[model samples]
Target: MAHSTDNVILQGAHGTFAKQLVFRQRFGQSILCKRPKKSNLSPTDAQLSVRARFLAASVYAKSVRANPELLVLLVKGLQ
Candidate 1:
């Protein structure tokens, strides 16, 4: 990791560049670092199950939001 306090173009610049470097602004300073390599590991059975559950919940939430009556009920319950 490297820190940059100068450089006009990179003063407030951020995000990945050239798919190799990562630039971010932190604590009023510019930071530069190498991009991490992608992981090639496969998800375990438990992870897959959790992901399936999350997908099902997301779909249900979207459906509920699409229905105005359900949305009103949800908001009332939140209170």
Candidate 2:
């Protein structure tokens, strides 16, 4: 079976009793095209940079979508 949440997607594995999972954790905040700041920019800028790097790396992976189980774990960890 497959399930969805606010930030994750979970599904069972094929030909196996185990389950598959996807999590959509915000790699970081999105950024707009603007001039750079002398003070190293704001938090949003930093977050956006990190997210971009993460996506760049993940795009090369086989299955880079979010995992539901991992999402659940992340949520739990946050709490």
Error of 2 at 76 (Å): 35
Q: For candidate 2, which ten residues in a row score worst on lDDT?
A: 8-17
Top-lDDT candidate index = 1
Off by over 4 Å in 1: 1-3
Off by over 4 Å in 2: 1-43, 63-79
lDDT string, candidate 1, 1-79, tens digits = 5544568998888999999999887888888889989899999999999999999999999999999999999999999
lDDT of 2 by residue, 3-77 (tens): 334422222211312233222223342222223335865578888999998998787442423666666666687
Error of 1 at 34 (Å): 0.9
- Each candidate's clash count: 0, 7
TM-score of every candidate relative to the true structure: 0.78, 0.24
